[model samples]
Target: MASKMTSGDLDEQFLTCPLCMLHFRDPRVLPCLHTFCRECLQEWATKQQPLECPTCRTQVSLPDQGVDGLKTNFYVNNLLDFVAVKKGAGPGVPCQVCEGGQDGDKSWCVDCAAWMCDLCTTVHRKLPGTKEHEVVPAEVLKAEKDVSKFQRKRHCHKHKNQELVFYCESCNALVCTACTVVDHRPGNDHNPVEVSGIADDKKDKLRQLLSHVDPRLKEMQDALKEFDKETMKLDSSRIESVNQATSYFQHLADLLQKREREILSQIDATYRGIGRTLESQKEAVESGFSRLASARTFCRQAVDYENEMHIVEIGEQAQRTVEGLLLERVNLKPEQDKVQFSERVSVTDFKNDVERLGVVSSTVNVDVSKCRVVTKTPVVGLECTSVLETADEEGQAVAVSREAVSACLTGPKGNTAVPTQLRAKDEGRVWEILYTPEVTGRHRLEVMVKDRDVTGSPFDVVVRSRESAVITIGSEGNEEGQLKKPLDVAIDGDGNVVVLEQVNRRVQVFDAGRGNVLKCFPIDNDGLFGTGTDSNGNLFVTSFGESYGIRKYSQEGELLATFNPEYLRHPLGVAVLQDGRMVAADKQQKSCLLLQPDGSLIREIGKGQLQDPWFIAVDQSRGLMFVTDNRAHKVVVFDLEGNLKFSFGKRGPNRGELNGPTGVTLDPAGNVIVANKADGRVQVFGPDGTYLRTVTTTRGAPHGLALTPDGYVAVACYTGHCVELYRYK
Candidate 1:
């Protein structure tokens, strides 16, 4: 039978099926408050050992003998009935009020037995004086109360008209009002609602609230799962590094790349010549296209007039070109495409060959291309030649230097002794005796830096040496006015300095010439991103993932795409390959990720035996990838197809061994420089894993290191406030 059902004319939208993801009709509301469709449940019950509700995931214990009885529910039948009537398949009644609400508060009159609203009180008494038609509110009716039947089955409420029938004390039911007046009311002062099922109703609601709270609490637990790891809890190791500020770019290196220089310079010269030509052409076009001519003369010249008789008379054809004194030739070449500006600002860099070192953990290995760091003590001679003594009006220009060295003896408190192993330039012998350092630890050897023009600036390079009695040298820092150690460094295509900072989540880009920061872009605030620049000047960053994935950003630092697929976990290193693809090394996930240009997931590479690929480097030309595993202390090699090819390095503090090596770089000469962050040194090795010399950094906590194309070493130290640029002397 169909039934008309409505709830005040407002239609309600329902969630259809979780499987099909549609709005539900014919809802089969279960006791668990989850709903499904009749056909859906029957299909699920077809060949089942046991039946269960698909929505609430509740197990159903049906009687084994009768399968049909437990297959469908009355609630679903009611929904079907309502829809059938809505389509005019059955009765059409205006159900202005909903059948639900106020716990079924409205009740049907015994005379009519039809539903009635609160305003239908007058109609409810249609047949008045008929023993005050037994009445009750709708909520009491939900308890399945029938007032007439209940009254007939009990005593009157006002008069206690049970004829003194006594209520049974054991049974918790109303017998007679006469019994309540006599014995029931006085004796039943002890928790009466307990017997009336009110206590049971309250208990049911409390149980419902408890069940609801549990799932919400579980959802919160899922969100906090990533932070419950070993690494994030510990203090970062390289918080104590030193620094010196310098900027070394790789332009000179590009100037000598075989025929590449000549080709590019030829193109540049052609462009310069084009610029000169465009300037002249633009002037001519502007003068001719201007409105200096008369408008009527210009309009007359825009068309041509010829007569057929004149053409025939002048041989076979005669054509005359129209000319007005004010009108000239008009040549519009579409404005040369409006001198188009690059929509993209090549935040990458003005130059093309240089690239930023990707972001990495402080526990990865770094390589120095062909650049080598060596220690040598230059010969010294102190013969004060007074070329021309001039009296100083403002001040006299003199060489001033201060150094702390236990290797060099304190010469007579004030005057420093010039070592005996020196000869003058006039002696015709320049490379004479070597004045090596005396003591054992890292040393600082100083010489007075002087410029012939008296306008040159001064800086220092810390000399580091062991007991081999070899002279040591390092690029300088903290020289009263210099910045301390830098936290991180990234280089763009033009060899511009970009730093992924620890204290803040900003990617800092600096000019190569001045070493001054030009722009800063912010990334994830937790500071786990590996940053790299693309050829189009876009910034690609890899940071730790909460739900396990990588995030990409534009050069202006806008979020482009994010994916949490089966890629690397806790990614730390990010690099853009030449093919516009992106790669990242995840430290905790122990793998690397590959991303398409649109930030789509395009296969991940290097997983499984990798413990912690803290930093990843890509040599796109060779289709080879290098990932540094911090705990294993080796570099895992992989091809573009995610195949494991080879591995390098082991866990140890030996010369070739890595001790929490943090940064890795491939110099133009194809050598690898490992910035052993813990060892305070950069270990250089050949491309074939040959043991090259080590350039010891005197700076503490030297975490990041890179080889500039110009053969300078750029190091990021944690404790120092600035990045140090080094030139190998």
Candidate 2:
């Protein structure tokens, strides 16, 4: 008897045709080397010409006798017969060909896929149709262990007696001997080839396909992992943002609650104070009434007395008491306290105060083209106009519509001013804003287009008695009052304009009101770059190139002190705080230096962040220092402690863009004014780095910047060789 088939017997299952999902029936191969069941191949061939392989789509040409011309896989037939014999020979297996009672199987027919008993087996072999069928000994089949080498072939469905042994290339069909002659004749242009010759080639093609797909599959897997990691990061960021917002709002809520408690406490105290005053007045009035009642009771008792002597005795006392009571000034009518609260104010009034408790919320405006101050003369108690150009993101002008644009002017005291008139013009691209300031000072004009702040909006408008440059100083020359290559200009504490001449190597002091040179002194070094004045009218100058240090001199040109720190390689710009601390821009060091009054270096700021820092300005009120990074094309702001606060500007030729920024100073309105050497314009910014407006334009490069006490910007034009003055606030 044959051994029982185990799981190892199914090792040859991969040999099955994918199309039929079964053992290859009449196994025949295509040119691509892929094998399929004879009937499946025949059906696939009917749909196409130039016969493409079902597995890899490789085209094939068939021989004339059609499928009958292809090679038969006899090796598959032998293996199938061997497996059938082994399976059928197992104990207790019944003969499938038996008609009545079950019988033990002795052999199996591979082509018919059935088991037969010993008697049936003999009959099967003797039959004329099965006379040539190959049969293997059942014991011999069970002796084999490795079943991977086996292949099974099925018989032709149409002609059960004959095997499918050929392929038709034209129809991509497989056929039996009878089919080849009937349906796929040589005269019908059918091409056929031996199936066994192409099997190895098709197997090689499948391996190549797997090699190409492996790396791509790995790439997709890696990408999915990266996506998961990024998604987690985004989720964490979202949670953190939400938490921060919650904390901020919670702080505001706590403040409001504290304020509410304080207000309620004040209201309670006022009510108690008034109540005490009324109670004291009532007590005094009640005491007077009690005394009057006693006096009236005494007079009545004296009248009721019957005896003459008793009446007389009591009458005298009663009369004295009555007279005393009448003349004692016991006033019955008391003046009302009149201590009462006025009616509670209207809800509108309370709302107005409550709304002003916090910052005025301005609408976010992004659709803006340009914004500029249009008022030629900004004087106190006079109307000033600000013009805003409105445009969509695509640069097209918006149509006329009310509330499409809104603007609010904030004064120096942080109060929003009501505009007298706001109207749109020029196809809604331009908006006219007019308002009359009540008091003289600096006013911030904020204009919005489509609820978005326009470019250079919120300008600093200086409202004063007069708004014009008092005088102009210096020209192209080396003569007494004339200047040559004036690099920097500054206004001293005594209202003097100190101009540093680079080529002439001299410091010239000019009367700011007259523009007349008051004093001119030649310096020993030719590298004088910047000039500034301290609060005590002391002059400070910075030298670059061969002599890299900051020199302090008296108003009369006497050198007071010199600060040459090791870290300060090339000092280019200098500014003095009110407390005498100095901020110097060190070009070679690529940093800004904060120095004590004694010329000692305190700290170095923006070390790696600045590239070619050229100018420095200190805003003492805000404790901020603005430095111009010339090469980096930006203005970096820092606190007094040298911590970076924020920065703005980039390398471009557009508005709010800075290219080769040099001189820096703060206007009277606390706006940072920076000179753009490349763009030849003076750009102004709010104290917190908001771009305000471009105050003025210069023909040549504007370098040294100084704001005069009279609200004017003195700009020293390097290429123009002159100092130009413009009214700024």
Candidate 3:
């Protein structure tokens, strides 16, 4: 059974041509069940190599006679006739063939294309020249279905009473039967065929076209689903990261509140002390004024006595009393109060010790070199290299290898460094970049292709300090003058090496003359880690475990003062300048602190730049410091003011490379000596961070390094059982 068509369906399917979307005129049908106007098909065929159905893109072999050779849709012509009659029946329509009076149309002549009453249509049919003309009853036309497919009359413009019946293949035009003999017959190549012959073949081709479109549509749908899944994952990750950040900042906020209370209490105590002293001074001045008032009253009463003798006797005593009171007032010296309060009091230089406060920052770092890569998965550590492809306006990949790809690295100190090597692979679609970073903390790695950022570009690389030892020192033992798990080393004024061993809590002094033990002393507590010497031959040491402070000692091992500042925690490296200033690197604070000789903190340097600074060496003449950042795999140089001059070395096993570098010092020539604990080698660099040479290639986890006055470098090896001394210039 055929499905019933509504008014809307009839309007779309029958009333208009598929090609021109207008009322059908001379409608022709192809075998594909689609219909177009004769003129539209002829024009469309001329543009195509082989005629094709415009709706389905089906290829068609044209009849030699062109468009007119196709079958005409007669049903469409009848529908058009019905619609015209219906329109003429409306109130405004008038008969075109009427002589004077405007008569409503009752019938339509298909050939003459005239609307007339019953009289006109009858007359038009009876005329000798129009007797064969086709006329339809106006009321009968209203019963027709499929009126949309109705075709309108199209007659030859030049010839009278002739219908266009044939097509000219050579001229690609439609013509009347008379036109064939007059215009088209002159050409023998004008091969004409009936239009009905090729209609079935064209329809079959349209069915084949649908097969190619189905799979491509399915692929697009699948891609959209995958894209939605990835988008959801990205949103979930963003929410999780926000929650973690909130928790971390809450912890910092608590710490800040505690510090705020402590500082306020100090301010209150200062105010109370000054207020009490000022009150006491006010009381002393009031007492002196009362004595003078009593003296004046006594003198006035004596002058009121009745007898002259009485007056004279009382006057002398009164005079003496008043004079004594007046003299006492003159003799009294007022004490000016020296104590005063300042208009405003503040905690200046609060960052003098980093451990006293918390640092807030919003930077997040990820080290690409340490990131793991999954097979057949999107790139994680660095940006995905796929975005380098050329894309269309809709962001779909269109072409590959559209531009040159490049990459650069910027260190934590804002120094931009070009990659040591950058090369493309996989037909210029993939790139490999190599660079060495010099500073610790967050570094930025950027990849660009054609002046555009690659996917997930500008990766944050968190670089850690290197930990390597150059030479080995004393072996582990419990005997006197023997080292056991030594943690720190320092050089004395007399060129003796001071070593602090944590396991046995012993401090051993080794004589540089024969590399023999000179003296051994025991510390009361354990966890001692850092040591240094002042210009006056005073030794300073820092302990981490039970006793957490810096300890000072005389040359003869006599205990001096222990400085336990509230801001010093987990101190690892200590250095003494020629001006009696001390610098200590605090591991917990991740900063280096400068202090006075009395252990009062002056300022902190490299609060965010130094990561786990373990050992330090001072070049007094050059006013510079060399520090080994144990976790960042670099040696950082700084001036006394804590400004970073430069830094060098990266984590690796090769020469001039540092891995777990722990011990650091400077030679007489102002060259840097570093100990790599991971590779057990000593690498030397020039003052400007240029690799000079290697000192010792074999050692076992050297932890502390010290340079003697006589040009010998002593290393304290934690794992190796012996101390090795090398003379380096």
Candidate 4:
């Protein structure tokens, strides 16, 4: 059997039971070493008691309950079924497991746990091992108690194979034959019956209940189905709402994108404009710095040129190059007096340039094409715009001789309204400005244009010029603060400064700082043309006040008496000599007057030789006096003893010409500053009358020139509307 049966591999190990004849879903090995599927054993042992193994003919005890391991083995059996083949068919037989002759019977003994027909059961009953085993019906071994109550297991109530038979409805239990007859009696209120009848009755009642509930139950289910459909619709609506919100989100995103582009454009434009302005300002600063250095070098040379007068000093040489190198000045086109900042200062690029130039403040980008002004004349009534550009703080060192020019304007209206915008007949367009200033100076012409759409573009107008050397000290205006003629003014030895107004009063003492009225001392009748200072800091004002001579005052409103110098008609200036002597220039007589400190008369400038003598200046060190004459447009030098030394200056607007010349003063440095009125300028001269340069002014009236010991030059800007004091380098 081992060789012919094939020495098989591990796969062919399972066989079907001889009784049930089915492969195992859940295979189990019987105690007799015979195998059976779990469900096959239950069917085979139906109505059997103390069931025995079919293969051994041994009265084997069968398990009352199914084993859990075999039940879970169904999954493993599935794997086996794929590889296994069906077994050979076998002949029908009785139990095939009984040891006695009953095994050959026509019926199986299930309750006795033996395979025997009715004939063999009798013999098996007497067998030693099976005598106590109960007998049961053939092929009906399944007992009521041994039947599976649930899906998992089945078991007998007592012995292994005799399944419980009759069920007692009165006790709600299943019982064997003895229990049925004994426990259940007829009509003693005990109802006992076969389990099949109960099962049939339950089935019939359940069927009736189902028949009654179907339609209504289906109606409720249909209602639930409709509610589910409505819920799905709402879900779709919610999704659509969310999608709409997403659309709005997209819209806002687009708006923000556009806004960002606009803002970036503005930023780029602003920076570009800044770059241009910075370049211009940097040029100005560098030029100024270079000029300053060169000018200082020349000034030093000039100062040292007087080798017989003063000593000089120089700085030490450099040991090494400057580190971290900011603010180093390099010579660019050195011969042309040009230099550059170490780095270009560009707003857009931050790079600086080398040439000197001018930059218009963003506030005052005037339309020069629309403006028409001339020498000695001013332009007004023009509208302009103002946009506050940043200040070039580092570039402020640019030298501007602005306080020495007198500027004023008259218009058809009241005081000109200089607005922040320009609205004009030309539709807010720019006009060309033709400025013909009477003097050479730095001027700013500001104009603004406001359009119909209320939109504006800031445009810049530039007027770049080399600053002139001028030193004007007075201006002209109508007496009631209106337009009128103006005259020379001066700060005398006293702090009391005075000006010749176009008013009837002729001379007004506007406070030097606040421009407030001090006193309008009328002196035209006295033919007064100049004012002076004495050793005591008193104002020895030479006016035609008393007998066409000079008068003296103690600064604190005191009348210190007057002088009627002999041989003097109109005195243009008065001065105090170091030794208490008085000097006066009589322009009407073309001569000088010398007075005793005691109000007595001394000598004269030849008692007759001078011409059109207008102003008197004294060189204290030389003990000499210089006088400017309008008739000759020349200044004649005179010794303290009233003797003419030399003469210079002219009537033209040339280098030394004194056009409408007025006040004059000798600076402590022996330099002479003359207020040239008609020229609308102030000119500087060397001690020997050499034309140095022009002193310019920001305003139109730098008429009276006074320098404190500390170089503070005060100019009484009379009709120009204000008085300003400037510190000179």
- Assess every candidate by TM-score: 0.35, 0.37, 0.35, 0.33
Give the runs in model 4 whose Cα sits over 4 Å from its true position: 1-486, 492-496, 500-526, 545-547, 606-608, 697-704, 708-728
Model 3 off-target regions past 4 Å? 1-474
- Candidate 3, lDDT over the whole model: 0.60
lDDT of each: 0.43, 0.64, 0.60, 0.45
* Selected candidate, larger lDDT, 2 vs 4: 2
Write model 1 residue lDDT over 57-99, tens digit each, in one string. 4455544543333322222333233332232211233222343
lDDT per residue (tens digit) for residues 174-265 in model 4: 55555555656636667667655554444333233334334433443454444344334443443453343344334334433443344334
476-587 per-residue lDDT for model 2 (tens digits): 8889888888999988777778899988889888876557788988878858898888878988888877677888888888998888878778888888888888888887
Of 1 and 2, which scores higher on lDDT?
2
- After TM-score superposition, the amount by which residue 563's alpha carbon in candidate 2 deviates from its true location, in angstroms, is 1.9
Each candidate: RMSD to true structure?
Answer: 36.0, 41.1, 41.0, 44.4
Stretches of candidate 2 off by over 4 Å are 1-470
RMSD of 4: 44.4
